[model samples]
Target: MMRYMMSLLAALMLWALPAIAQNSGPLRIEITEGVIEPMPYAVPDFVGESATATEMGRNLSRVIASDLSGTGLFREIPAQAHISRITSFESPVQYADWRAVKAQALITGAVSVDGSGRLVVKFRIYDVFAGQELGNGLQFVGTQDGWRRIAHKVADQVYARITGEGGYFDSRVVYVAESGPKDQRAKRLAIMDYDGANVQYLTDSSSLVLAPRFSPSGDRVLYTSYETGFPRIYVLDVASVGRRVLPTMDGTMSFAPRFAPDGRTVVYSLTQGGNTDLYRMDIGSGASTRLTNAPSIETAPSYSPDGRQIVFESDRSGTPQLYIMAAGGGEARRISFGQGRYGTPVWSPRGDLIAFTKQSKGRFHIGVMRTDGSEERLLTASFLDEGPTWAPNGRVIMFTRETQGAQGQARLYSVDISGRNLKQVQTNGGASDPSWGPLQN
Candidate 1:
C-alpha cells in the first residue's frame, strides 16, 4: 500500500508541474505588418435576469465595444446584424450567424448580483471564423462604481490577445492645465483617468507651474513652480495634496524635475550663477549633488528605465542636443547628431528608445531614437509639437501641439510608435506639457 501511494504522489506532481508551466507561458499573439481592412467584430448586449444586472451587462458591453472600436482597428457590427440574442448562460452560440455578418470575432456575456451585493460579470470572446471560443471566459466581481474599470479590463484583455503588445487604456495622465491666454497662462497641476474621468486638481492656479511628472509609485508628483517668484522644484503628494519645496543651493533655480526609477530621488536642472546644470537630490535628506557643470544649459533630465543612467538636453555643443550621463554625475556623451535642436529628452519606459522634441528649419517635431541615438524617426511634424511623453508600454507617444495663428490653440495628441492613429485628447482649455502616468492597479 505504501509503494502504491508513493507512485500516485509522483504522478500527481508531474501533472501539476505541467499546469504551472502552462500558466506561466507567454501569451501568444499574431503579428502583421498592417491591416488592409479592419477586423469585423460583434458585441451583443449581455443577458441578465434582474433589472440592475441587465443594465450593468448592457452598459459594460457597450463601453468595451466602444473602447475597442475607438482604436481604429476593429469595426463593430451593428446590433441589427446580430441574428441571435444571448438569452441563456448555457445556451449554444450560433457561429453561423456571426460569420454571416462577416464578423471575425464576437463577444457575449452575462452579469448578476452576488450574495454580497457586488456585481459578478462573466464574459466570453469567440472567434467566429474558427467557430470556437478563442480563450476561456472570465468572471469579475466589483462594485457598481467600478463598472468602467471592468470594461477597461475586458478591452485590455482583448487588445493584448489580438495585438501581442500590452494595452494602455487603463492608465492615467498628469498634466499642467492651462487657462486664460498664452502669455499669462494660469496653469495648475491636474490629473485624470486616461478616459478623461476623475479630474483632480493637485495645485491651485495661484502660481505658475510647468512639467508635472508622476513618480514611479504614482503617489507623488515633482514639478517646477514660480511660487517663490523663481522657478523652483516642489514635490506634491497626490493623495493628500501635501507640498514640499526641495532643498537647493542659494540663488539657484531648479526646474524640469523627474523622479528616479527608484522613486527615492529627483533629477532636475539647476541654474546657478547664470549657468544651468543637472542636479540630483535625495528626497529623504534633501541632499543634492551636481551632475554637470558645463557653461551651458542642461535641462530636462530623465532617467533610463533601469535607473543607472540619465538622458538630458543640453546646448553644450553650440546647438541643443541629447546627452547621456551617469546617475552618479560623471562624464556625459552626446547621443543626438541630427540637423536640429533636440530638447525635452525622455527615456522610454521599455529602456530601448528615447523620445524627444526636435526643432529644425522653422518647424518642430516629436521623434524617438535608440539609446545609442540610431534609427531616429520623427513621429509628428507640425508648427509646434513638443514635450513627448511615452505611454507606459512605450508603444505610443503623447505630445503638445500648438497651432500657428493669433487664435492658435494648444492641445494634447497621441500617436503610435509607427506614427499611426493620431488622435487629440480633450482638455478643459488649452493644455500643454502632458506627462503620462504609469498604469494604476
Candidate 2:
C-alpha cells in the first residue's frame, strides 16, 4: 500500500511541474527578418440586435480594427477586398472567401442592447486557413455610456489571443501636460487612456509637476512637485486625484521616486546640503532606510518584478551610469560601459532586461540591455530622447522626445523592444514624463 501511494504522488508531481513551466514561457511573437510582419485578417461590421446597437456595432468594429492594425503586427484587409460579407455573427464563416483575399484570420461579432439598457458584445476569432474557431466565443456586458471601454475590452481579447502577450489596450498613462512657452512651460499632472483619448487633468498648472511614476497596483502615482517651493515627492491616488506630500525634513529635496513591487515602500533620492543619496521609505510607517551612503549622486531607482533587486542610475563612477544592487541595498555593480552617460534605467517587467536613456556624443537615445549590460541596443536617437517607460507586457516602451532649438517642444513616443514600430503618441498638446499604468482588470 505504501509503495502504491508513493508512485501516485510522484506521478502527480511530474504533471504539476510541466504546467508551472508553461505559465512562464516566452512571449508569443513570430519574429522574421528581425521583426514579424503584421498578420492579415478581416473584421466585418458586427450585426446589431437593436436600433441603438447599430452605431455601436459599426464603431466597435472600427475601434478593434484600428487597435490591432496600429500595432504594426496585424494588417486589416479592406472591406472592398473581402470576397464574402458577414451578415450574421452566428453564421458559419466562408473560409474560402477570406482565403481568396489572402486573409489569414477572421473576426465576427454582434452587439445588442439588453432590457437593462446595457451594451452586450459577443465575438469570435477564427484561423481562416485552418477553417475553425481559435477559441470559444465570449461576451462582454457594460453600461451604454461605457461603449468605448467595452470596445477596448473586445480589442484586448483579440490581441491577447493572437499574440501570447497580454493586451495593453485597456490601460492608462499619467504624464506632465505642458502648455505655454518653453521657458515658462506650464506643467500639470494629467491622465489619459492608453490611446491618448479621454484626457483628464489631475492637478492645476499653478505648480510644476514632473516624473510621474505609477505604483505596481496602478491605483497610486508618485511625482515630484514644486508647489512647496522645493522639489518634493507626492503620492496621488489615480482614481480620486487626492494627493499628499511624502514626509521630509527642512532644507532638503527629494525626487526620482519609484514604488517597490510590493507597493508599501518607495525608493528615491534625497539631497541634503549639496550631496545626494538613495533612500527607501515605508509608505505606511514613514520609516526610512538608506540604500546608498555614497557622496556621489544616486537616483532613479526601479525595482525588479520579484522585489529582490533594483536597477538605478548613479554618478559615483564620475559619469552617470546604470547599476544594480540587492533590494535591501549594499555594494552596487556597474552595468553600463558605453561611450557616454546613461540615466533613468528602468527594469523591464520580465526582469530579463533594463531600459534606459543614454547620452552619447551630441545625441540622446532610448535603449535597452541585458541585466548584465550585454547586447546593448539603442532604439531611438534624437537631439533629446529620455525617460523610457515600458508597456505592461515589457515588449514596448514609451518615452519623452524633445525637439531642438528655440521653438523646441516635447512629445511622447513608443517603440517596440525589437527596435521597430516607432510611433508618436497623440496628445492634446505638448507632453512629457509619461508613466504607463498596468492593464485594467
Candidate 3:
C-alpha cells in the first residue's frame, strides 16, 4: 500500500510540473497566414541614473517603443494598462505583473551620463511568461546628441532575437531632394536616417542631380550630376561632402551608376553616338570595360549580391524590358515578359528577387520577380510609380509614387513584399529616387 501511494504521488507531481511550466513558459510566435494578432509588449520609462539623464531616459524609452511597434509584428500595451512599474533596471522583473496585463514581452532600460559627457544606455528584454531574459542584456555608449541612434540599436537587437531575421533600423537613405514646382524643380542630393531624422544636404541646388546610389559600405554616394553642362557621374563622400566626377570622354554622357558588391567596381551606362551601352569601371584606376555592345539602351545596371550576374533594363527587344547577363558581359536572357514595359531593375540584397518599375495600359506599378523570370508579383500600381529600392532585409520595398495630372507630385512610398503596409515617407519637400543603404555595423 505504501509503494502504491508513492507511485501515485510521483505521477501527480510529473503532471503538475508540466502544467505549471505551460502557464509560465516562453511564447514561440510563428508568423503565417491572415489576420494574426501582434504580440503584446510593455516598455516602461527607462530609469534615469543621474539628474542629467531624466529627460533622455524618457525619450529613449519612447523611441525604442516606437521602433518596435512600427514594424506591425509587435504591439505596445498602453502605459495606462500596465499593472506594474519598473523602478530599477537591475531589479528582478515582476513576471506576474506583466502577465496580469497580458503582455508577452517586457522591455526595461536605464540611462546615464558619464563624466566624459558621453551617454550610456543599457537595456534588456524579457519573455514575461517564461520569467527569463530573452538572451543577453546590451549597452551602448555614444554622444548625448546621438541618443536616438542608441535607442534604434537596442530595438534592433530585440527584433532580431524574436523574429530570427536581421534588423534594418540602424540604416540611412540617400535620395534626390527637390524644391520648387515640377516644371523647373531644383534638385540636390540629400541623405538622412531611415526614420527621416538627421536630414543633411550633400550638394547645392546650383545643378541638377539624379539617381543617387549608395556604396555597398554606405560611406560614399554615386549620383548623376549635370554640373558640367551634361549628365555625368559623380562620387560623393558622405563624411566630407566632397565629390568628384568619374572619368568619361569629353562628348560622352555617362549615367545610371551602381556599385558592385565588391565596392570598388562600378557598372554604369555610357551614351555615345546615340547608343547607350553598359560599362564597368574600376574606381581606383579609372579603367573602363564595356559590358554590353548592343544598340539597345542598357542602363540602370545592378549587380547580384554575389557579384556573379547583372540585371538591367534594356530596349534591345524593341520594348523596354529587363534582362540578365554575366557580370563580365556576355549573352543576355530576357526575364520580363509581362504586359508592361519594365525598367530600373534593382537586385535585392538577398538575391531572391529583383524589384522593378512597370508601365502598362497607362498605369504604373512597382513589382518583384524571381531570378529566373518566374513568380512575378506586382505590389503597387498608381499613376507614375517608379524606382523601386529594397530594404536591407528584402522584405520591404520603397519607391517613387507620382500623383496624376498637372499636380503630379513625386513622393517616397514604402510597402511590404506582400503588397501591404503602403506608407509615404515624409520629407521637407518633394523627394524621389530613394535609395536605401545597408544596416549600420
Candidate 4:
C-alpha cells in the first residue's frame, strides 16, 4: 500500500529540502524525461465555509486526489495517516506534522456556496519541509450544477503548478458507447467528462456510427454514419444534437473525418470507383477538393498543430504505414519504417509527436513517435488496440482495446506518453473510438 511512496523524512526532504535551502522558493517536478518514482503528497478534506458545502468539500478533495494520483506521478498520503487536521481555510500550516508523515507537498482548500447557488472554491499548494506555499492561492466560481468541473479545474491548477506542464483534467471525450452482443452490437454517440462522468448520449443506437472526431473548438463532431445505408460523413452539434450530412460525390463512401486547425475545414477518406483516397472539404460552402488521387487506400487524416501539414495512414508502399503531406495534399513522405502495419496517426497538440496504432505479429499496440517518425516507442500491447486519441495536453493517449474470445468487448484505456500509468477509463458499458476534446475555458 505505502510501498509506492517513500519513507517519512527522506520523501519530504527529497522534494522540500532544496526549496528549504533556497528559503521557500517555488517547487516543481520535471516530467519530460519521465518520473521513475511517484512523489508523495497530501490533500486533506477542504474546509467548508457554509453548511451546505461540507459534503461538497469532501467530494471535491477526493476528486482532486484521484486526478493527481491517477497520473502515476503523485501519491496521496491517505487521510488516515494525516497527523494534522485542516479545519479552517486560513489556519497556519504545521509543516513538521506533514513531514513526519512523509508528505512533500500539501494541498489545502475551502469551499462555499452562496445564497444565489453559486459554488466557490479556493485552494493553496504548500511545500511541507519549506514551511511555505508554492504559489499564490486561487479561486474558482461556477454554478452549483458544475461542481464536478470545478473540482477538475482545481486539480488542473495544482498539476500545472507542480509539474510545469498543462493539465488535461478539465476536458471531455466523445466516443461510441456500445452494447449488445458482438455480432449485433448497438452503438451510440456519447460524450462525457475526461474522467468518465456526466455521460450524455448524443445519438441513439438506431444508426451505426464510427470514428467520431471533435472540432477544433469542441463545439461540433464529425463522424461516419450508416444511416443512409452507406458510409456518409455527418457533422453534429454537441450541445443540441443537431446533425447534417456533408455533400459528397454521389455513390462515393466517406468516412474517417477529422478537423483541421481551422474549424471550418474537414479532412476525410472518400472512396469512389473502389479506390479510397483523402479529400478536404469546406463545411460552410459544401465544396470539396480531392487531395489524393492514388490507387491505394488513404485514410485517418490528422493535422499538425499549426494546420500546415497532415499525417495519415496509407498503404501506397504495399503496407499500411504512416505518412505526412501538405495540408492541401501532395506527394506524401513515409514516416513509419518499423515492423508491422501502422494506422490511425494523430498529431499531438504540442506539435511534437504523433500517436498511432500498430499491428505487429500477433499483437496490437498503441505507440508514439516524433513528427519525423523517429524515436518510436510502444506504450501498450494487447489482443486488439486501435484508434489512438491524444489528450489536450499531449501527455497521454486514450484508445480502444478489445479482448479475444466469443464474449470479448471493447473498452477505453489511456496510457502516459512515457509508457506508464496504463489504466481503463470507466464507462457505463462498452466504449470505443474515443476522441478527446479540448480542455474547457
Question: Tens digits of per-residue lDDT for model 1 on 1-441?
Answer: 112112212211211222211222332223322222456788888788699989988898898887777666667999987887778767888988877888777888888898988888888888676677877999888887888778877887787775555777777889988887667768899998775666788889999999999899788889999999999899999899999999887788889999999999999998988999888889999998888888999989999999999999989899999999889988999999999899999998889888999999999999888899998888889999999998877877889999987677788898766666788887777778888888767
Find the candidate with the highest lDDT and give its number.
4
List RMSD in Å for every model shown: 9.2, 8.0, 8.3, 4.2
Per-residue accuracy of model 3 over 305-377 as CA lDDT, tens digit each:
9999999999999999999999999999999999879999999898988999999999999988888988788
The Cα error of candidate 3 at residue 187, in Å, is 0.5
Candidate 4 C-alpha lDDT tens digits along 249-280: 88999999999999999999999989999999
lDDT of each: 0.81, 0.85, 0.85, 0.89
> What residue pairs clash in candidate 4, if any at all?
none
Candidate 4 ranges beyond 4 A from true positions = 1-25, 31-35
Give RMSD (Å) of candidate 4 vs. truth: 4.2
Return the TM-score for candidate 2, rounded to 2 decimals. Answer: 0.92
- The TM-score leader among the candidates is 4
- Over all chains combined, what TM-score does candidate 4 have? 0.94
TM-score of 3: 0.92
TM-score, one value per model: 0.89, 0.92, 0.92, 0.94
lDDT of 2 by residue, 283-333 (tens): 998888889998899989999999999999999989999999999999999
Per-candidate clash tally: 0, 1, 0, 0
